[model samples]
Target: MPSESSTLHTPAEARVRPVQQWWALSGRGVAKVFRNGEFVFAFVSPAFLALCFYLPLSALMDVYGVDYAQFLMPIIVLQSVGFAASSAAMRASFDDTEGINTRFRVLPMPLVVPMFARLSTNAVLLVVSLVCAAVACLIIGWRPMGGVVGTIGLFVVALIVGLLLGLLADGIGLMAGSPQATSQALVFPTLILGMASSGFVPVSQFPEWIQPFVRNQPISQFVDVMRAADTGSLTWEILRPTVWWCGGLFIAAVLLLRLGNQKVRA
Candidate 1:
């Protein structure tokens, strides 16, 4: 026979539905992001990037007939997305290092509930970062050359890419063992891929030997597709590579997430 006090705490009280657990955890994550000043960085980073690049290189790019600000918008936006994803990684790493995930594993919720919550927090941050990026772009002379449909397509692509990147980063964080290690893991890929891609300059401007690689890389593909979408000239041929790259990223993210789950259980 249980004590009267134990009877007051029923099984229903002890066990929440997965959805409820997920929502509660998500709320906690979202609140933490705001409370910790991550929200301010979401706005500041894009603005800083826009100013740094647009001021120093705009004149040089003009000599080549490039509207540098307009040309730079996609990358700026992508950088903001990247920033959000990196923050997601940091959050996940902190949770892992602090044993929060281990505590969650001992709870009655499903294994995926905490991941879903982190993802939800990432989604919110992604959207905020995108909006901030757009505002930064506008300040630096980027305009929507794409009409309604094309503009919609541009953002849809960005959202998908951001979500996928966030998922991958979350897994990387979980596997990294420490916050500093997770950040170090992300730095090389972000810097190398960002600088090597078509986002910063025209593919034709690169050395002939590197042109093929520059034109075909995933970041380059995404940038070209985004540029085409911006100008209302998007075609299936232009978008095909982006689709494939995104598919590959999705697969990678899934595998990383699975590994992260296993690590938590261990």
Candidate 2:
């Protein structure tokens, strides 16, 4: 007869142990992030970005009657969200390239388990990035001017945006063929959207020719909503575009994840 320990390794046992598997995999992902020093980068990136923009542009922004510190907070936080999503993509890409995802497929556990574990890891990192971003904003003199409910709303919006972006990035990583390619693919768009958006300066600052694009882009809308939330001035007109953008992101993430899952099964 087969050994008792071997019998415990049957498919039925594996199916029952998905929770354990998810926890273990989540731990592994978190550990890898620490080992690779991404945890440190999570703190450093936001702080660096804040200082880089704040020191040079504060005087100029003040010329426009803007408090640069307050004006700059939303983008810094959003950039941190972007960082978390990029990290998620890299983690997924590494898993794909190293065949770790393939190995998981051979296991008897549900196909969704690994994806959930990765999402858990992404969630942890996203929260850390937001906290660090908050610290950076505080140091630069960004305060919560919107009272208790508004402050909570500010972060709630950020967390929702971060999670959706993370899900989208994870799907992209799985679909990409290589980690280098994944990084390149994400970097250009991130740079373009971030720089082109109203996050850095008022949309009126742009030339009349490009102003329409700058004003109407998704990133600009996100920044506007976040700023309104912080100042207790959010209106339906300001928030409607963001709601639609978020809905679109959700749909895109779901479709990409399904396609990625199919690619793996194939």
Candidate 3:
């Protein structure tokens, strides 16, 4: 009795009831992103991220006599995390335009599954990219003095921050209507925040005005945490600021997710 097109809906699909099968929806979310070309480059991107951006900047900082890779490691970790999150947002946007989201809406799947699953998939991808960065660090003479705890902490921060950035990117994608614009929006914050808040120079290097503003900013705090972890330097200055930065970004990401969903669904 089914229509010819209805045959395309598997029996499994019909049985995946709403609330009970949220995880199944996540699987679909994961599948959708991998279908695109993004994952193909994820494994190698850390090398590119280092060669194209982190290494060059670290080399410049070598004049300070601090280890180039050491000084740069935290910054690189944060950058990767943020960039990864932005990619997540872009992926969400892609789903919207491709009609993937529409399909999900029509199905019995839970709404949260798509976003969360997409996020989870990207998280794994970003972690792999971070590992690639770690290998690059080894190749370029960087060492992690923070030992196991610091190393773990750095990656953890990266994942959280990356997830948020992705959400932010997703929101933008909803508004901008294209991948290119989503990418630009993602890159701008990474550059501005990365350069002005940390890595390029210490907070002391900035003028008194810019110093106060960024002193408590996330990148500065993240760099401080990373700097310490990379070199075994410890300070309260880094801890408090990083907590604020993480919390703030997390809130922003959640808010953006809500806003993006509304925009896209509307």
lDDT of every predicted structure (CA atoms):
0.93, 0.92, 0.68
TM-score of model number 1: 0.93
Residue 98 shift from truth in candidate 2, angstroms:
0.2
Candidate 1 structure quality by residue, lDDT tens digits, 32-138? 99999988999999999999989999999999999998799889989999999999999999999999998998887789999999999999999999999999999
lDDT of 3 by residue, 1-266 (tens): 88867787766566665434656655765675578655655645556656666556666666766566666666666665665667776777787888877787777565676777676677766776677667766766677677888777666766666666666666676666677777787778777877787565667778888897677666777777767655555567656767777678778777877877776566
In model 3, how large is the Cα lDDT of residue 21? 60
Regions more than 4 Å wrong, model 1: 1-16
- Which candidate do you rate higher for TM-score, 1 or 3? 1
Candidate 2 overall Cα lDDT vs. reference?
0.92
Model 2 bad stretches (over 4 Å): 1-16
Off by over 4 Å in 3: 1-37, 52-60, 204-209, 233-237
lDDT of 2 at 81: 96
Q: On residues 95-207, what C-alpha lDDT tens digit does candidate 2 reach at each position?
A: 88899989989987788999999999999999999999999999999999888887888888999999999999989998987899989978999999999999999999989
Determine which window of 10 residues in candidate 3 has minimal summed lDDT.
17-26
Model 3 TM-score relative to the real fold: 0.80
| TM-score, one value per model | 0.93, 0.94, 0.80
